[model samples]
Target: MKYSAIITDIEGTTSRISFVTQVLFPYAARQLPAFMQQHASEPAVAEQLAACRNLMQQPDASLDAIIAQLQQWIAEDKKATPLKALQGMVWQQGYQNGAFTGHVYQDVFDALSRWQQQGIKLYVYSSGSVQAQQLLFKYSDFGDMTPLFSGYFDTRIGAKREMSSYAAILQHLQLPPKQVLFLSDVVAELDAAAPLGIGTMQLIRDGQVAGSHTIAHNFNQVEELIA
Candidate 1:
């Protein structure tokens, strides 16, 4: 069946996992405390700070205390929404200052471009905040890839491994589950979407972990599957 739209994961799919774990994560960790100290009064920044405090059950938590908890979350690779949002804020500055450009695989660029030309709506659904998602694509190596996507979803919608998350995305997309293809490198994520009848493809860019779902080594291979 021809797909009407496609939603893709970021790390390990369109981009190398190291780009996130090595480049982005470390940058955010090193920069977050200072960034928050400087911008905590700003509304968006304050909102997430308040969220962090609430989630940590420390409504009166000192800014420094909250920052410490956030750093712990970073070290633990926690997927807390406030932490992701704050990281996005930090990353926005990094991207603007040219600390780094987002890493996107070359074949991903080509195949996504081709699919755009074919009139398939594209989207991103990542554990990263929507702001982070936009920042990555906007400051991507290929330059201004934000235009290629129709929308973005983050854990704010739901966790990546939850069927309810894909169900919610389908609501926003207003497309049949079978008509939306979801691409990810993790089999659990593919399993989540597949049960919802969304087409699932795993991107095995590196190791030889196995899954029953369809697998692709690169975007070129992924394109062949959908073609």
Candidate 2:
């Protein structure tokens, strides 16, 4: 394999944008109010709520107020860490309840399985929380694909558009940047990885996405590129 490790973005890369925008986002948003009310006293939820409070500079924000703020964040699609964490919590229930199975492109599933068998380590780097990433693969439309990944990363390392995050991921993976390919639909993310000497691929799944990185319409094309 040209690359020994593959770090992929979730939305718009391995997964469909609509599944996230249309299904996941709305489901999480709708559940946020009741979910918060039910779990606010729990340590995990409280910790994230505290972070959300700190972010909003409302150290003593009421639960109702906080839920409203989170709803606003959801509406704006802000990549706030607290929001992502909470969304992950909500998604866990959805997956367990069989509300939805995460959508993975057939091509992506086949390519990922083949690459894993070939000894290429697979990892995920998404703005979504690591738990959310796990949940997606754990209950995917293709069934449990979580075992295929070596690790997962979220914005906690750093913003995806920033080069330092890719540097941090390289450090964690203990791999040379050239041997790690970062795939995403977003050009800015690919650009960030590229400067750090990471192999990069842009997934133009829906329409044209302007970028200098190698472009693939689906994972089959990505497979061909690396092969």
Candidate 3:
């Protein structure tokens, strides 16, 4: 209630889960192999590949091995930073080719604008890479909503369900946890934030209850709570 920063999850909270599971994930999975093959020599692509190798603890990993491991991670939706970074690259191609624009609920865009005007800083915390998060808002259904956000954080900091990640974010934001509101559809994520004294809001977009937290069915309800 006293927060100056509002951090939110992307999939299922700000955007429909279907857009991620059905559209975004599938597109990334389908295009990853080809994208990697084509850009393997590029510095950015090689950097992510090296990160993936480091994650796998195979410092001398070959490109083919890294690619195969990344595919496995993609299928599992692993929140590994390297996997997410690679997915962002593949998804960039999809976005550029007009596969699909990011999907966000109408109410979300309106509420975000209102909150921005009220001086509450907005940030995103997602399993998706920072690049992917930017792409989502930049190419959002509402068009170019990236400016609404103050910053983005991804798995590079730590896993979403880890309390340490919340602590790290608070440190980075230079704000006390009590003054930061963390929103997510997952109760475990809220649980992680709550113990750190961060305010918690559970987004119940699908009408499913999984944890003990304040639940808002839509961004309108969220706006009222923050107000």
Candidate 4:
């Protein structure tokens, strides 16, 4: 393997963005109202609600108002940390109840298994909360692919497009930046990582997105880049 560590994004890289927009987002939006209403008193649930209120600066916001703000955030696909945390809780129920299995691209499944077998450390860096990331892979269509990942990261570290986030990841990995490769569907994310001396590849799965980073149509192509 060309790198000792590889960190990849989720949406549009390993999974279709539509599954997120059409399936997961809608599922969360639809169930969030109920989840919020039902679990407002639980400490963990209450804390995120309080955080949402803090974000909204409406300290006195009623439960209905908080629910409305969360739904609005979901509609806008806002990457608010509190929103991601709440959605992860909601998705946990949905996955356990067999509402929907997480979607993983066929190529991604194959490539991830192959790369792991080759002794390359694999990690995930997604905007989705770490709990949500685990749920997706734990109940994934390919079934329990969570074992493949050595660690997971989310926006709690920093915004995905910020250079500091990649720097933080490198610090945690305790490796030279060049020893790591970052794969994502977004050019700006690749741009952020590349400057830190991380190998970068953009997964152009939808036939869109051109960038200065190396481009791959699928994980197989990504493998070719590294090999």
**What are the TM-scores, per candidate, against the unseen true structure?**
0.98, 0.99, 0.95, 0.98
Output the TM-score of candidate 1. Answer: 0.98
Q: Model 1: which residue pairs collide?
A: none
Q: Which stretches of candidate 4 lie over 4 Å from their true place?
A: none
Residue lDDT tens for model 2, 1-227: 79999999999999999999999999999998999999999999999999999999999999999999999999999999999999999999999999999999999999999999999999999999999999999999999999999999999999999999999999999998989999999999999999989999999987856689899999999999889
In candidate 4, the residue pairs with backbone N, CA or C atoms under 3 Å apart (3 or more residues apart, or in different chains) clash, namely: none
Task: Using TM-score as the measure, name the better of candidate 3 and candidate 4.
Answer: 4
Q: What total of clashing residue pairs does each candidate reach?
A: 0, 0, 0, 0
lDDT of 1: 0.93
The better candidate by lDDT, 2 or 3, is 2
Return the candidate ranking by TM-score, descending: 2, 4, 1, 3
lDDT of candidates 1 onward, in order: 0.93, 0.95, 0.89, 0.94
CA-RMSD of model 1: 1.0
For model 3, give the 10-residue run with minimal summed lDDT.
Answer: 206-215
Q: Candidate 3: what lDDT? A: 0.89
Candidate 1 local lDDT, 1-227, one digit each (tens): 29999999999999989999999989998999899889999999999989998999989999999999998999899999999999998999999999999999999999899899889999999999999999999999999999899999999899999999999999999999989999999998899889889999999986848699998999899888878
Per-residue lDDT, model 2, residue 60, is 90
Q: What lDDT tens digits, residue by residue, belong to model 3 across residues 1-227?
A: 36698999999899999898899888887888888889999999898888888889999998888878987887797788888888888888777887899999998999889888889899999999999999999889988999899999998888899999999999999998778898899998898889999999999997768578888998999978876
